[model samples]
Target: MEPELFIPARALSKFVYCPRLFHLEQAQGYWRDSEETRLGSHVHRVVDRPGSGLPPLQAIRAEGWRTRSVRLSSAELGVVAVCDVVEGVGDRTCPVEYRRGGPAPGGGPWPSERAQVLLQILLLVRHGYRCDHGCIWYDRVRRRVEVPWTWEAEREVLEALSEARAVAERAEPPPPLKHSNRCPGCALLGVCMPDEINELAGRDPEPPRRLLARDPDRFPCYVTEPGSTVGVRNGRIVVARGRERQLSMRLRDVLHLVLAGPVQLSSQAVHALAEQGSPVVWTSTGGWLKAVAVPVAGKHVELRRRQYTTSPAQGVDFARAIVLGKIRNCRTLLRRNGSLAASDRARLDDAIKRASRAEAVSTLLGVEGSAAAAYFQALPGAFRSDNRLPAPLFEQTGRTRRPPLDPVSCLLSYLYALLVKDLTVACYALGLDPYFGLYHRPRYGRPALVLDLAEEFRPLIADSTALTLINNRQADGGMFEVHPTAVALTRGGRRTVITAYERRLATEAVHPVFGYKLTYRRTLEVQARMFAAYLLDEIPRYTPCTTR
Candidate 1:
């Protein structure tokens, strides 16, 4: 396998707060740009806009502006990212990043932002710029906080980078932290379901306490005792059934066998009894038989069914319907704006036209663009199509979701990731207990629930949202002159996208089958429920909805 890439300073902040999250993003490469990430991109654009002021220099004429270009890279460490501003203060240089939000909790500058600055410092140092400090300019707080690169700060930055590298080494995300709440505004919140992991790992494993009573009937053949046995073996209570050697009782299959003498069972037996799906009672003097908790897995399949139920059609249909509705909403919103300039409209129309053409989507799927190819180019085997990337099955050919990299489409795609993230969040919110899963499989510390939840929405949310942005004038590469990377979004681009997403989500649509109008939020919850049902075996499998 290819070695894991080291994360840039900005990403290190994410890891420091939640190692699992850092793993999900950097290691797994399952990036789902969030509103915050997009917004940060948007802001970066504004900062990098032409004629952006830079510090003045002495060599240039008096009217000359002192502006220095910001360059960043961590190639040696295997991390890379760019800085917004690099200032030349006397003989020393400092990097400054504009924060989209307030300082971190306890009044510390945002760790990720600080990390970004440190990386910037490293970049400048590599390029022979005498760097000493970096500053984070908070937009919300309207304050600029300077970060001095002391030995401690540099060590911390390096340490954070090292830890991030370690986390990225795993294909799956790391286990959630023991005490999360370290980084309140972490972008990977949806990816890292820390609460669920914590709950599953920290819970006391010992069986619950039980009470027993004496029964005087069948057990008369055995000896008499009032105490309880502590351990069980071979699915049978290895207790002395009679005066002879210990006899095993099929605790699960047997209903009841009355005993006159006393039989004792340990607390473990009581738990085993309960796990058999029926409670057991052990008599102090009679044969030990009392109600006990049953292991959930042993419960009848029918019992599992009654608890959670959903249909294959329901889940896929729900996901597809949500995507379609959102796409339609995006089209409507763009048209209503009416004030869109010709160039912007032309760009959007071109994107939509491309999306409308059945060939484009197929072409996109086939092309291993530079961005995608860079990561996979070194792989051993030639590209081969499989079920995951099968040729179009539907009669209609076009964007299955939306065209890639359109501003609105970008927003929608990120929103899908957001939804997945939300599912990860919901997994934590709900105490279903198991932290890892089947499709996502339980690693020592992975949050399988979130991975499970995000599966169906990948096509529905992220792909569709990305298409919408392209099809609509809300965003386009024309603004930046350079075509936007499919994976990254500019800051202004992010805000425009997020605002539109929030608006689109609030819009309602009548469910084609249910006949009742449901908000996007409700649809997401239903999809989540269906996932829970699948886990409970109430559904056979999950399939994403395919549009005709």
Candidate 2:
């Protein structure tokens, strides 16, 4: 028989606070560090260290002892915990739990904290040690709040464990708490997406709370210089060519490591990055996403199962929504930045209508194709006509890929590739199979799901970034190396485009549906999660991100 699943004592606390949060962290294996969690870890440094072992209850009664970081487990209770501190004296023992922040508003322990300590006390009692009470050491307040064990507290703990176990056994997480004040300070606020999910699910009429922060301080580190090596030294990622140091950045500040072309990363650096949950993305010389090195795949097996088992009709419905959103966003981009002609505008409007009405993926593809043709025909109007560079810089080459025939098409292809890489990483981080998709059929080597997601953002992100580079004169003709067969960006040109792309990602815009502003980078993850919610049937429908 399979052994019973033992719930961690700490997870009990989270389950008490928010069942969905607990489910996301424990069952789904989703975690993102925040300021509050960082501070908590800092405060836990001392008590986290292993200390003197605790003797048996008889020896403890005889000699009164104190131990730090004591590991305890109870098979009967199906619970395990690493108690921070345990003090004993003459047949009495107490578990002391450490908290980074102060006590609750009433100068008492929170319910979650109480439940955690109670479980710890129960574990001690089951192990033949007398534990009547537990103490919570609040580092912020510099005081201890005592929680005396009682029959009622024990019942509460047992009930919470039962509920948490049920939640774990289920394929989907419980619905989020309704407008609770507890969500703001939660470490998994971005992952749980309580407000956004509630609002989207039609359970809440109010707009989503703008709790997610804007652009994060950490940014992607791109290495484009050929023959350069990336390694870790003194907690910093160092890039060097030969014996000369090229760049050094604190490892903490790096979101991920991007290796373009022939860049080399040391194994030690790879191990360090993996430990920190930062993936290493490898791309071809022309920016095609080749592989991603992560410590492990995402743990949400249910979501992937749902993705692979989706019916063709449901797939077409989802694909239609995505295509409609993409076409609408494309029109919005043209109207906002370019001098869209009446004929081209009419064609785009008609295409959007047809795309919305399209029933099959083939029909949707046809509608999207026509819409893109009209959109790109007017895309050149978005460029600056007065720029004194070569006329080829601003010329409209229609939309060419693979071996782009002109500089404009070349830049667009490169930016689209970067966008693909970002979405692919997002898919991996969220535990979705990047190769499986609704709109785009699964193929070897292609991230079909990522491509499907990227369609809507192509105009708003990649195309807009390319336009910014060309119209602002940030990219000149010299950046391109034109060959008879193909056009590619030089190292300097790649750097320039990458900088521009990063800036566009960092730019904040109001989410059309949620009505809260977040960086485009953050929005991508939010959209990915929304897609997951849709697949799990938490939300009625998938809504692609469309900026106004």
Candidate 3:
């Protein structure tokens, strides 16, 4: 008889939140990228460093943890999980997590982190160790608090695990959660527009009501009351007093009035006309705030509080750091250069470094043409750089071609696809207008919000996977193809790439910041929150991981 395997309670919770997320994570294996994520990776690396002399699980030792990404398999849950950090604390082995953002005091660990930690505990128990408690270290407050793994927590984790397994066993992605905020934050937001999808499904089809919130500095639109005398009628807005008989008035001509009844104005109607870039006036039966120019923009158009005071100088530094960090990581990954050469590495590095030190995000690239060219040059092959993979990768999904596809092209397309999907999701989740991006700048129909969030992790998540895939030889030319029209991965090609990607993520690597190792999936979420904090100015700058 075989030993009964115990699945970690964490993966289960992830499945509950979004089945597709769990599948991409545990089943198929996908990674996300952004500068925010890179900062998180750098922080975690500091914690997981082994020689720092920090007690096992107390925090990461400076020497770095022997490993950061540790894979554990459980027969009971039919699930395999990767832990962030696992170390011997006294006689008991413990798992310590470093979160990018702080959770609410009574909120416990986030469903995501809790699930990850629970999985670690289960893995230890499988090894005949008694595991009960875990720690969640938050960077914002810079505190590590213990999460008691009680029987109730165990039960919840188990329940979540069962559901996660079921989700991974499926072929296609799961449907979006009903009106969930997560939908907007996902990289797949554009691909899975929940609101539009729901409307099309005839579920929650009617748009929600918009009760106007008060903002005094609004463009004057006509307000009507009873018994007011006629001024002039333009068929748009009319003001009057009612209950007996009332006359219409042109908003521009109306001056003052006496209220005989309730005052009413068309807030939506006014907004619609305003949004058309048309001029409109406002007047009231009682008293009207005169409309001067009939403001072309809506009253809601206000600079973001977070961005309002940020100087170009400061923003430039932040953007520079992000670009340089990405270039640095790319160089680090490429030094071993199975496909991309040392010359290629230097070119890529110089390109991003120049951009980073530039006066602005847009001009950063223009300042150094060589660096810019290098950065663009490296993009095509970064995914299939052939520096970090194993051979004979599995292909369960049949998503890619079988042989001789351009490794560089395939990797590039896949990364673009993921980035596009992620950007779409982030836009919806943040409730920001998608067309605007601080870094990428606003483009017509582009979800700049997605681009902004995704920028912080591109190196850490997507780039890491590409390196792993090519270097390991698990996925190669066989997994991709380029048509005269377009480049894409076949189902088998996709499956092989994803399987290897997941396996690599499950591989343990040491953290330098938190003295732990976390699965790539968990790391992506952590990075997302950290970027949110950065945008909110909770953190001053983003820092990416650098090798000694």
Reference-based lDDT, each prediction? 0.45, 0.87, 0.50
Return the top candidate by TM-score: 2
546, model 1: CA deviation in Å?
A: 25
- Tens digits of per-residue lDDT, candidate 2, 10-124, equal 9999999899988998888887777898898899899899998677755665567788999998777778999999998888999999998889888989989888999999888
User: Residue-wise lDDT of candidate 3 within 100-166, one digit each (tens)?
Assistant: 7887658466777777777678766766655678778888888877777778877877777666656
Q: What TM-score, to 2 decimals, does candidate 1 have?
A: 0.37
Question: lDDT at 371 for candidate 3?
Answer: 52
* TM-score of every prediction relative to native: 0.37, 0.96, 0.37
Candidate 2 pairs with clashing backbones: none
Question: Which candidate, 1 or 2, has the higher TM-score?
Answer: 2
Rank all candidate structures by their TM-score, best first, as comma-separated numbers: 2, 3, 1
Candidate 3: residue 412 Cα off by (Å): 2.0
Q: Tell me how many residue pairs clash in candidate 2.
A: 0
Candidate 1 residue-wise lDDT at 470: 41
Query: Could you tell me which 10 consecutive residues in candidate 1 have the lowest summed lDDT?
Result: 211-220
**Superior by lDDT: candidate 2 or candidate 3:** 2
